[model samples]
Target: MSALPMLHRAVLAACLLSSIVAGCARKADLVITGGMVWTGLSSGRAQPGAVAIGRGRILAVGDSAAVAPYVGSRTRVLTAGGGLVMPGFVDGHTHFIDGGFQLASIDLRTAATPQEFIRRIAEYAQHLKPGQWITGGDWDHTLWKGAPLPRKDWIDSATPSNPVFVTRLDGHEALANSAAFRAANVSKDTPTPPGGEILRDPRTGEPQGIVKDQALGLVERAIPPPPPAERDSALARALAHAAALGVTATAHMNASWADFASYRRMERAGRMTLRVVLYLPLEQWRDIADTIRRQGQGDDWVRIGGCKGFMDGSAGSRTAYFFQPYADSAGYYGLLQHPEASMRAWIGAADSADLQVTVHAIGDRSNAMLLSIYDSVARAHGARDRRFRIEHAQHLRPEDMPAFGERGVIPSMQPYHAIDDGRWVEQRIGPERIRTTYAFRRLLDTGAKLAFGSDWTVAPLDPLLGVYAAVTRRTLDGKHPDGWVPEQKVTVAEALRAYTWG
Candidate 1:
């Protein structure tokens, strides 16, 4: 044969082989292209990238050209349009159902004055039938001068027909109107509950209708629980809101068994769009363990193998069990929700059951105590991937800072609280101790795992706002342009890592 004919034959054979390979390539169910794709891995990002999905799992992720083979006539295509294509956010802690209700209830978070707070509640109450309990205001009294906690008298007249028991923005305290107090039978003679307080008038000795910590339950118990329909609606609303904000999963703190049932119902009904990890109250650990034993820890969409407990209250409410008295409240050390002995026992039991335990520790004393408890529990259990966490590890003593990493504890913190509380935290704890408040950088530097959250319903649910707070530490009051406790401000990269991967 001639040399030219032989070369032409070789070229044709190569073309046929390429065609055969292309014909055998499987098509993807969906193809997402044209964006900056962050793989959430060490390989870094892929610019102008594409992702192919099939059978509800990612099949390929790389530059657009690399994924082109997966696209077929039946494949659904989505263009990112130069936007970011990253892993969906995972909110480490939330009161998911409560946040859903808050989204639908009157928003008093923006009420800047006493009159505005009353007006908003009154207007919201007007829509309800007489005797309907109004809840979920999430009011922020700090916006007002002096930041005086609201009293019953402030909204008594406005809420004459309805009982009003609205929570403070931190969810650690609540203000009840006269109607609410009357319904709860709260009186000046009523004894304060352990680990709680009922703020009273100084001279008159009358109950001011401001309840802190566990005392909020006094008024809360008097209010009727929302109907099943309302509960379902709240969960649905929250899920939609989370999806819109790019939150793919949330570890719901203080979840009830009812919440778990609702989540499972949603999953079965094909209404669930986001993943949920439920941490029931520590008191229910046995029930949770039994349930887990029977059903097993759930799939990727729903998990139920964690217990949440409170060591103390929050800083804003001044019940955050502290080693020393609060600067504003002379001789008054905050209250501990659980006795040291009881807390240790519960934690040990949970650890033995192989359940993850995360406790809320907002004060230096509480954080230190919980850390000690965790260390003791770890020693007893031997080495394991316990991953015990401290929720709202907000205030810490300088000496206790190293214990987090040393003890293999995760600091599940909310960054927005730093900026939100910065507006008035100094008034509660004073200047020197405020240095370690919301110590994100310090915690990270100590080698503690960082799991960021929004504490939605107490603060905004938007993770972007959380990132801003983490990176800037700018007070919501607009007083600190350079950043509040600027020393604690983390780099944007660090903040993003906490939100996404940590």
Candidate 2:
């Protein structure tokens, strides 16, 4: 053997040290390679690259070759194979528990005609015991070719064996049979509750089977609450169904404290697969302060997020409080779900408790009222980074658009609503206000953070369908080839961001 020179030995030591240093650096547990990765980064950039995940957090993101070294021999690899690899999408708002119940309940979504609706209910009633309430038919008469609103007489004769109460798709209206009316003891003499109306026949002045807004509560109060076991099964089935649809995260809107406990129990047992963010009903905030103070903001998976308050009912039901009168009923503006004073009080409480507030404002007046309340909160809170949200900011005045961005309010909107409601929206608000209805472009232009969702049970939970609707503004009936309000059309990328981690 030849003796090594000092210079050569020093060079060899340097090479070994470099190897050791590189080996000691952090390594990734899993590295996804060979795909187009849209990071949903602020810059909105996409590159052919790889992502490195260790334990749970992302370790690195760079070129495939550079990231490959971090992948250990034990690591499992996923080859994207030219597919898009993006962050899991987040449905900013939904009613998961209610949606779960809807999945299990009597579905009336497809009864195109009033006769067809009666036939379906009669079919469902055959399986039930006599006098047992046949609940949960989310029907819409507007979808029928002639678009005629049905009366009690239509379903009364068919479902006479069983009492039936079917909600309108928007939950703003309900069609009840005479059997249901008799059970609830509702009569023509009964007075409508504040902020609610029972549609009556013009000729005879009798209850016309349609109950609008808070009037639904009259019939709803007659139905018994679901037992705990039934709720559990519903949630389990919902989680499984949501997982199948590629929904990794969801936010349950307008849930009460009792509902939150169910979610917490499910999460603790590791039975929940999708991430859930619960929003307590605004009125129930005082009851959950201690629980929320301990839990605060949630992790990436399950959390108690905020409170949801209703400012107005939906447009389809003619309960969405408008500045001007509805076309069908002159001098008859829609009702407000919450008074301005009541909204201010609830919002102030939510702010004080450090809870992010999400208000449902579907009409221009409702939207404006919410904006004013949010503006007040901003001034009182003094520029804190709390991300307040406006659930279903569906209708707006052009002047009020900028307030959303100025106040940093995230418009947690449902795009499917526009497509679903657009077919008949003109009849409700007339042509002029309809221009500002479902104003996605105007909201975006004002720099409002538009967070998209399906509202699930109200519409389909499939986010892809929502993306198509938002980008195309296509009515469900396929009426407009050019698109409903084509000017409000958003890009595929913008719709994708609203559904993605955004």
Candidate 3:
């Protein structure tokens, strides 16, 4: 063959290669079919359907009969067997890393009483190295017959050698031992920070070793950060656990850009199974703004989703900022973490950047302040398609009921928090305010988008558990047979939407 003929043959081969590559790129690798698919589309349109996936993108979704033709010889097929195939659940508020950390720690979630709680800690303490931080035992003592708070005295002997700090399931309060207090350099004389509290012995005028709300920082600062490898291992376990529960995505509530970087690395490595949307703290607004200016905005699956601000703490801790006094504790209202002005500024910047904003507001006053801030920011931003969220919209004022929908704010709530908090909320907010607290039905009726979440590490990550609680309104102890605040109950469909579609 002549040199010119050989060159012509090479050119023809190159053209064929390009054509084959384009054809392969356009072909779908898999098709899912034969399911009662609920598309979650508006106007209640649904049918026996199929979805074709190509390169991880949905190629098409429609009648299975029509989509079956797209299945090529090489395509993998999945039949749903007439099962309900809905969009994967999305948790709008979670602490992914904290959830992972909890998974790796000693679980004391079933500790029925203070004694059992101390025993569990004592067992965990025996295995730890000297001077190591004993962390993440979310022990709830409210289930005790008298619903008493655990004092340091009982756990002192159990964990005498090891420094111990066990948080309440809600994370609003914690019990620390003498060793932990000494390790953290905290004492009875140390004044509590603003918006926090230190429980004290009335007669002795000494610290009782119970720290509430913002006071948890007194002990947390003493613990060190986990290594990168340890974090990755825990995160892997957390994602697998999430997948088993039918979760496809989640919105992390208090993640930093550093955490976002870790997520990105996981995504690139194909190790991340669930879609993640991270919310940065409001304190890092300027830093995030400068970074966003350089890198531009992110996408739906994994993005710098929003700014998270705290308005108050949990009602269980009597630290949820409210308008009125607690019946038991005279003149006591929960602490307010941020002022309206500060919250407003955070919202304004987040809105302008088109970033979603989610605020943690568990008390009536906190919820009211959040609503006011959302209203102002929405007005200033003009007509926009932003999804503003209010995390843990736990308590509500009657007058502020309509504001949630009117301002187009989403109530990103955790239903388990209601079941957990309902038992003691009345003591903190009085009976009148309790009527409107955890009003899921009322929020939906007033036109708010109620996005359900587990707030894992705070509650179990099982959406079914949450759905059961929302529909039943049953307290943790099941004290109220008919359900606690039954009027606040939501239907199965509404509860489903909060977790699955909202």
Off by over 4 Å in 1: 1-27, 43-48, 65-73, 202-205
lDDT of each: 0.83, 0.78, 0.77
Q: Estimate the Cα RMSD of every predicted model relative to the unseen true structure.
A: 9.3, 9.3, 9.2
Give lDDT tens digits, candidate 2, residues 1-502. 0011111233323322435324535677887898887765545667787776665545556566556667788777888886777655667778888888888888899888877888888888888887888877788888787678778888777678677888888888888888888888898888989878898887876798988887988888887778777888788888877877777777888886666767777877878777777888887777556676776655655677778888889888778888888998889778887678988998888888877788888989888888888888778877776678888888889999998888788888899988888888898888898888778888898898788888888898888888898999989878987779989988888888778644
Decide which is better by lDDT, 1 or 3: 1
For candidate 1, lDDT tens digit of each residue in 1-502?
Answer: 0011111234323322435324536688998898887654544444567777665555566666656787889999999998888666778889999999888888898999988987888788778998988888888887888887888888888789898888888888998888988899988888889878898988877788889987887887788877777888999999999999998778899998888888888888889888788999997889989999999989767788489999999888888988889999999889898789989999999999999999999999999999999998999889998888999989999888888788878899999999989988898899998899999999899988788999987888899999999999999889999999999988776777677666
Q: Give TM-scores for every candidate, taking all chains together and pairing residue i with residue i.
A: 0.91, 0.90, 0.89
Residue runs of model 3 more than 4 Å from their true location after superposition: 1-27, 42-46, 203-205, 297-301, 352-354, 480-482
Ten-residue stretch with the least lDDT total in model 2: 1-10
Top lDDT model: 1
Candidate 3: RMSD to truth: 9.2
Q: Candidate 3: lDDT of 140? A: 75
Q: How do the residues 1-502 of candidate 3 rate in per-residue lDDT, one tens digit apiece?
A: 0011111234323322434323333446887788776654544444677766665555556665445545788899998888776667777678887888888898988888767877788888889887787888887777787778888898788787788888888888998888899988888688888778899988876778899877888888887777777777778888999999987788887886667777776777888888787778887777777777787645544677657888888777778887877777798887887667777887898778776677899888888888888887888889887777788888788789888788778888889888888777776667788888788989899998788989998899988899988999888877887889999898776787677666
lDDT of 1 at 92: 85
